[model samples]
Target: MDKQLLERVTQPLGHPSTSSSTTTGDTPGVNEPRRDYETGTGPSPQQRDAINQIFALLRYNYHNQFTKAFPDLEAVKTGKRLWLNLLAEYPADVLLKAAERAVKECTWLPNVHEIIVRCDLASSLGVPDSWNAYLEACRAPTPKREQRWSHPIVYLAGKASDWFFLANNIEEVAYPVYERNYAILLRRLLAGEALDLPMEKGLPDHVEHPLPRQEQQQRLRDLIADFDHPGRS
Candidate 1:
């Protein structure tokens, strides 16, 4: 392997590291700056690092295949750049997960499309994608146990992850938890485990009604009078 070539290809184009370490004297959690990847605008430093690591692993694991695929070192560099562009939209963790999948599943040097498809957690698995599942989890009507879920996995994940937390937190904080839970349940389902969603309880056989408007108003006045004079008849 040409270490020089690897260094050149993996180096960040121009952006400085956006790591928390770069922030001096700033309180750890109070007002930390948001990195590019947090808002999903572009590839973050972490994404860059993760992809670079993926390339390193691929080069090591598929040296002969990589040499055959790329005619020269320059071709290898071009291929890496192309991959960076193609995968820049994904989060760092997603990229790493996809690369891990490719390493395990592909018999040869996997193509960019293979990695991208792996990154797509929902479409590849035939389940509702994590993003849509997240929306469903967040926006489902209250009494969530009874709402019609897109998939049983979605409901199970949301319930396991805490419906209240999923509903209240921002996507950055909440989606990952939901996504992880969803993935775990998905794995179990794929392994033939049956996930039972909570059964919606039936309405009672009998129920009470509130008093009519006139009677309710009369009752309210009587209560007020009683409060004003406790012994009044």
Candidate 2:
């Protein structure tokens, strides 16, 4: 987020010739900046410099500390390459924060892998706000009787699916509950069944029932019998 660093990375390359002097088979213009195949845009000079800056900062601040911690510590000759690889894998902010955290926590110089691990840990600390909001919305009351499904769970599942689509954080929010129940919920949605998700302490629990109480009891007994008898009907 550093303005100077951002400018350095994003500075535009010189324009290539708009002239038609060259023939169709001629080589590409030199002034035309090389495009990143993945992004289709020219790479920024600042991004390149930032990669070196990060490595330099780490070396300057922690080289001695690292040497003191490990007397046999070898010179990090490939630190720049390693750091550049890290930059490719992570955003600048994430790498910077990871480096800062490593510096604070490590007694010796930390390796690029260690900093990356720290970044992963930091990333896993919480779900995004959008996911949290979606979860919260799942807890909201269903619409009025005439306008909505009779079953709150069915309504919730529909809403949750819609929320997941909009959230862009399905991997974080969809887990043991959502992943497990998605198919069953989809069935209920398609069948127009009145879904009664078991509630615990006023919050939704995972038990889903598309059938009435008698049917559920019968199903439970049948399941128990099946378990007891193995392959028997």
Candidate 3:
């Protein structure tokens, strides 16, 4: 990496050594200037340093003509602040990978948003490619009794019930309504009524329940009927 670019990137954040140093005085020390990274109960010193290094590398590469467009020092500082805010949610390695990808693919110097978009894409690449693969991956390694209810369908059903209750403002009779709707949805899901078109090509195209609208309506009707006749099956 070019030394000039490193200096430029580090100068705004007061350089890593100065930022991390314990010594304090009139001179520029770690404690002298409060940075966006240092404010508001942020990452540990090590994490802060790692994020700085990532910014330095990105800025260095951009200034070195790896990207056709380069951001000025102030723009880089502002962008770094935005990136640091995301560190709590996204892993540093993932963000680094995102930065690397942006640098490789984009002709212009990528902003924080562009890097974040790449991070989402990179993170999604780890997901199982097909629904079957996803189900297999979701299976618990240890066969615990509680793990039986940990299936994806159960989770989705719970979400669906919560959504329905909220959407319909069913506060007074939340429990029975939620239970009925959840069971109905779960039944449909188990009966192969929740599948979608295979997202990836070459996978089986004729999976049952290419769309779930019909099943959803049927289950909804069952829920409504249960509500209408509270004591009836």
Candidate 4:
């Protein structure tokens, strides 16, 4: 919102503007110097300016970055993995749609993190990727076409532990959805959550579930359902 501060902050450090009409040379027009946001910060002015610069860069390069990174279906697919963990926080349809887009449009290949981030985001949104081995644990009777993270409370906790271990083994980190769900599990555990644990973790406390099992699924389902569908009970 503050224009002058933005200008001051955005002014290039070494390179001066090369505009023909403007003689200030300090200006940031067509050949003008680009601001350095990563340096100098004792006063709040620097931080505020940094925020402004971040917004500007985001605004100007938002779509462009995506465009450059995702030129074809492969790129989208490659990039899609980054969002995998992120997808766990949302609805299944939403995640599937995102996956579909990536699977369809990206030209460049993405890293495992990309797929995992989407999964994480999905989990954060309440959508998790379920393999047949995973979904069988959801309490979905028949294990429907679309796999969900958890169905019941007992197996869910155990499954979460399993998944967390798997994630660790895979060396995944910071994927929002998975992290969110994982946190949720811990919070409930700390609260002495009531439910079953299907896994064979041999947890000493009746409070915390160590491994994922069928009983854990039931407990997790019940616990999550209480929060997810408060009106159902």
Candidate 5:
């Protein structure tokens, strides 16, 4: 990740008192995270301005470079700044940890577990764009202050691989997403199939996001127990 990108990743986690007025559900966007970053919790006015500017830059970059549906950092908390240093500081671990937090404390939402497991797999497999594309399209969940659950984000770690994450209500319609996309990318790369994601964006090969396979469900539960609710273990 670029130094600038990581710099703009985090923000002080807050609730309805000072959050975006646009969101409705648990879908992820710019909101204060619930982490225990002392530095992130509160900051001086000068520091706040610097953080906000970074967020603005990130939002602009994310919208312009990625799809239009993607929300920028500004959409998080409107008044407070975040601790994005954590992103560059501990990118993958932080995300996984956040998921864990939601799992343990959050009143169960199967969809939440689904996104976490997907991200875990994507991180393990290294595929972020797949998740990004889907998130850019998925409707933002409602009940704003609730725990953030981004199905598209979980697997953003796997941008370099040949997988694109996708979601459908039925299981029977899953594998084809992964298989077809992988095949197309491979064919295109072998002999220019019209579109080939540039190498600069990591690697090119978009498979579908990990389906809610038995392993995913099981592992996600485990992630919640282990990372978020340690007491449960």
Candidate 6:
């Protein structure tokens, strides 16, 4: 979050852009986010540079508005530290992006929760909010593996919690299970892990055992009986 780390995060992941290549220019604004930060060692004292830059952007952009909100230098420092604590779990650069968006969108200086919400939005992207994610998992069509999910994390969470448990339980019981599973998946996502669902295994091209018709019927009956009283045998 410090200046050096901010510089590292702001740098393009690859070659410079054509405009930059064509002419010498000042570095991009400090508030510009490097999404690559998602893959970096998490927030530390150095990461405070990103937090500092966000405040700097707000102070400059919001002018007297930010000053009035903070009132004094001490207040500003306290506010920055408070934001860092509240938002430390997120990548520093993503928080900067959220700050940048707030500067654009807010008529007045936004609050810490507003900024945190933006960071969550940025982190989750296409994924729904936790409640909505739970609803999506609950309402997904049967043969759930074959259902088209908005994101694999949703399916992954539902699978981890057991689709039948989710379907049978009340939200008070089910939601926490889904939320916990979703949170684990969300962190994995933020850490840049792929969350693609596993493909459903299908029948082999040829049967390993060609049962006689009567035997196959008898086996089906036995399987249904076992399902009805799984503890029996």
Q: Name the best candidate (by TM-score).
A: 1
The lDDT values for all models are 0.69, 0.46, 0.48, 0.37, 0.36, 0.67
The C-alpha stretches of model 5 lying farther than 4 A from their native spots are 1-41, 65-75, 78-81, 84-233
lDDT of 5 by residue, 15-112 (tens): 22232232312445634333222222322222333334433444444444322322344444432232433222222332334344434554433232
Better-scoring candidate (TM-score), 2 or 5: 2
- Model with the higher TM-score, candidate 2 or 6: 6
Worst 10 residues of 3 by lDDT: 127-136
Q: After superposition, which runs of candidate 6 have C-alpha atoms over 4 Å from their true positions?
A: 1-124, 202-233
Q: Residue 156: error of model 4 in Å?
A: 7.4
- For candidate 2, the lDDT comes to 0.46
List, residue by residue over 27-78, the lDDT tens digit for candidate 4: 3341312222122111122222322332233323444454455444343333
Comparing 1 and 5 by lDDT, which wins?
1
Q: Flag the better candidate by TM-score, 5 or 6.
A: 6
TM-score of 3: 0.36
Regions of candidate 2 where Cα sits further than 4 Å from its true position: 1-47, 65-77, 125-233
Which tens-of-lDDT digit does each residue in 1-233 have in candidate 6? 34464343333222222231211123243122221222322234334666777877876787667767866544664576567668766645556667888888999888888888878874566766455677888899998888888888888899999999999987757876886787677766755687798966898998887899999999999999999998994
Error of 4 at 168 (Å): 37
Estimated TM-score per prediction? 0.52, 0.32, 0.36, 0.19, 0.17, 0.42
Checking candidate 2 for backbone clashes, the offending pairs are 8-46, 9-46, 9-47, 66-109
Clashing pairs in model 3? none
* 1 against 4, candidate with superior TM-score: 1
Model 4: lDDT equals: 0.37
- Give the TM-score ranking, best first: 1, 6, 3, 2, 4, 5
Off by over 4 Å in 4: 1-61, 72-129, 133-233
Best by lDDT: 1
